[model samples]
Target: MNAFQGRVTAALADPTLKTAIDRTTNTARSKRAAAIAAWPEFAQARELGRDMKDHVIANMEYYLTMFEANAVKTGAKIHWARTGQEACEIVVGICKAAKAKSVTRSKSMLGEEIGLPHALEAAGIERVETDLAEHIIQLAGETPSHIIWPALHKTREQVGELFRAHHTDPGELATVEEMVSSARRNLREKFMAADVGISGANFLIADTGAICTVTNEGNAELTTTPPRVHIVTAGIEKLVPSMVEAMTMLRLLVRSATGAELTQYTTFHAGPKQPGDVDGPEEFHIVLVDAGRTTMLAEGLAEMLRCLRCGACMNHCVVYRQIGGHAYGATYPGPMGSVITPSLDGLETSQDLPRACTLNGQCHEVCPVAIPLPTLIRGWRTKAWVQGYEPLHTAWALRIWEFFALRPVLYQLASNLALRIMPLFAKGGWISKMPLAGGWTRYRDMPIPQGGSFLAQYKKRQAAK
Candidate 1:
């Protein structure tokens, strides 16, 4: 087994983790199916969403320039980053210029991708996560396991214990609501005292120069509004031409992400606090990150740019459901991650990610933008094979199989010989163990051969007829 498969085997041994993943994924899958089924025009809407994103990607340079111009006009400073280190440096520079002592953040996967928290802490700036799930993992010194629901792998009991250990009081908070209230009380102080706030944008409007964020807890609003310095970090692909296109994408995003028509709050910020505005930031900054996106665009993997950061693909993925997200061991996880991680991190480092999937195509079926995830994964597999990255045993086995497959007489002779000799190893119509097939038979029995070759069966049937 490869390293990725080894991790998956280890994950499968944890029954508690399996139960948590199964319950969460099953619930999310049911809700998303029901939500999509309720809308008669969802199919057309999905196609339209895909088309809009494709257009933006094709004309990415033009839209990015237009966005920068409009944002400058609205008095927002824009910064472009070509690498993760550059992105982190830009953020730290802004904080340092503002003399920020404490920074509060809303959940941004871009922030995670660039390792912003470590950068901030290394600079002696306090970094606080305001989102509930993010806050939980942050306190636990762990990374997000899923995109939308970062802590889905943790049970309520686990969260309660985490809160008890982290919170000041050891009070008996027996229910989820009490635990949430405890976390809120602790995070509220951080929000009020924050000197700088960082957030991720769901959609960036090129025409209006708006940065849009969607959240259930309203923490993103607080993160953007209360602090004196507000910074938005987002992938370059988040840009849309207008509010209409943004709205259409939002419709698909919320439904695919959480099975909701809309999140509790969807806030849009065009610039810093206006002259008449009561509560808003004094300075606004938008950072466009292009760590590996330009490379992806040049390659044929630009189809992945259509993703809305919705978790539906992972929610419905059989491999993700079985092994959970942590086994992938990358920033993103599941089917979409399998395709994009290899492109961003290179096929050499992330080769196991593509092999983690079953290529069952369920991810393609449920994708809000209809990205061909399975086909992209197969492309990676082909790339790996062509580059001679295939395991030695697998390569030899395929060569042997191909040699016999090309010669029908030898194939039939070998098959008949196997059929006659296999009974020596059969017990109760099953093979309990085998030398070369331990991977398959280790956990379960493999069924013994039941009849002669398919060609023999066909010939006998023809003669009887």
Candidate 2:
């Protein structure tokens, strides 16, 4: 097996991981359903969100320029990064210029994508993840398993163990409340001591130059407030034209993400502290990272830019439900990852990602922004095949099937013969081990064909008529 297959096998073998993923995802789905049911305008809001995002993506350069102009007017420094490495360098330079020793961070998938934490550590600046889930994963030295739930794969017991091993107190860590309190006590000091704060923006309002952030635990509020220097890192796709459109996106985001009408804290930062302001950052910086987004847009994957990052697609995906996020082994996971990871990371490295899906269309059904995830995934699969990325055996099998499929008489004869012969190897109408399909049969039995093929049954019915 290949590297991707190996990860899938390992994830499948972990029952605990499966249980955690199932429980969390199931709960999220139920909550989302209830929220959607209560909101009669959900469908209309989704359309508006999609239209606004499309408008921004279509005129990305214009909006970005407008945002920078307004943001600079508000006394916020704006920096543009063409790549992930450049983005990291920009953030590191900002910290260095401020002479920052310790930094507190809110959860940013963009930061994780660009390896911001490691960059800060390499520069000898301490980084503290203030988000509860981010803190848990940071303590354990693990990447986030889910986009919204960074430590969704871990159980309460595992978190307690991580705190015991990492936290200074090692206090009683039995219940959820106790663990949360312990984490808060530890992080309170870090927040106070932090010289710089780094955060991700859920939406960047172009007209007003406001950075919109929503968080359930209010960690983002603390992360961005107390620090002397504040840096906001986000992708170019996060731009919305104004507050009205941003609010529309926010409505879709909170409900689809956590099944809440609104997050506990929805904070907006326009710029540095004003003359009369009591408390805020001394300096504010916005780092807009293109990374591979421009390339993706130019190459006809622009619909992906509409992503709100609510993770409803992941929660509803059957394949994602079974394997969880880690099995995909990318920064993002699930249907969205299957489509976008190949584009960002290169198809040669992640060729297996698109093929991991069953194309059940649940992802498309649940997406709040109406992204056609299955179609995008299929596009990646086709691209991979065109680039000769498929294994030799798979190529040969497809070729052989093509040959038979083109010859009607021979195809029918072969199908009839195979149907007659397959049952010989079956016991009690199921084949536990099939020669060519060991991958499927290894995990579950395949039922033998009990009757004639569809074509034959159709022909017989026509004759009767």
What Cα-based lDDT does every candidate model obtain? 0.90, 0.91
lDDT tens per residue, model 2, 1-465: 889999989988896898889879999999999999999998988888888899999899899999999999999999999999999999999999999999999999999988998999999999999999999999999999899998999988899999999887858888989899999999998998899999999999999898899999999989988999999999999999999888888889999999999999999899998999888899999999999999999878999999988989899988888788999989999999998899889999999999998999998887889998889999988888898999998899999999999998889999999899888879887998767878888767888997898789999999999
TM-score of every model versus the real structure: 0.92, 0.95
Off by over 4 Å in 1: 408-435, 441-465
**Best candidate, lDDT:** 2
For residue 347, model 1's alpha carbon misses the true position, in angstroms, by 0.9
Q: Which pairs of residues clash in candidate 2, taking residues 3 or more apart in a chain or in different chains?
A: none
| Model 2 collision count | 0
Relative to the true structure, candidate 2 reaches a TM of 0.95
Instruction: List, residue by residue over 1-465, the lDDT tens digit for candidate 1.
Output: 667877789888877888888878888888888899898799999999999999999999999999999999899999999998999999999999999999999999889988898999999999999999999898889888899988888888899989988997636879988988898888887898999999999999999888899999999998888999999999999999989999999999999988889999998898999999999999999999999998888778889999999989999988888788889988899998998888878899898889878889999998989999999999999999899888887789889999999999999999998888766777888988876778767756888887888888999999999
- Per-residue lDDT of 223 in model 2: 91
Please name the candidate that would achieve the greatest TM-score relative to the true structure: 2
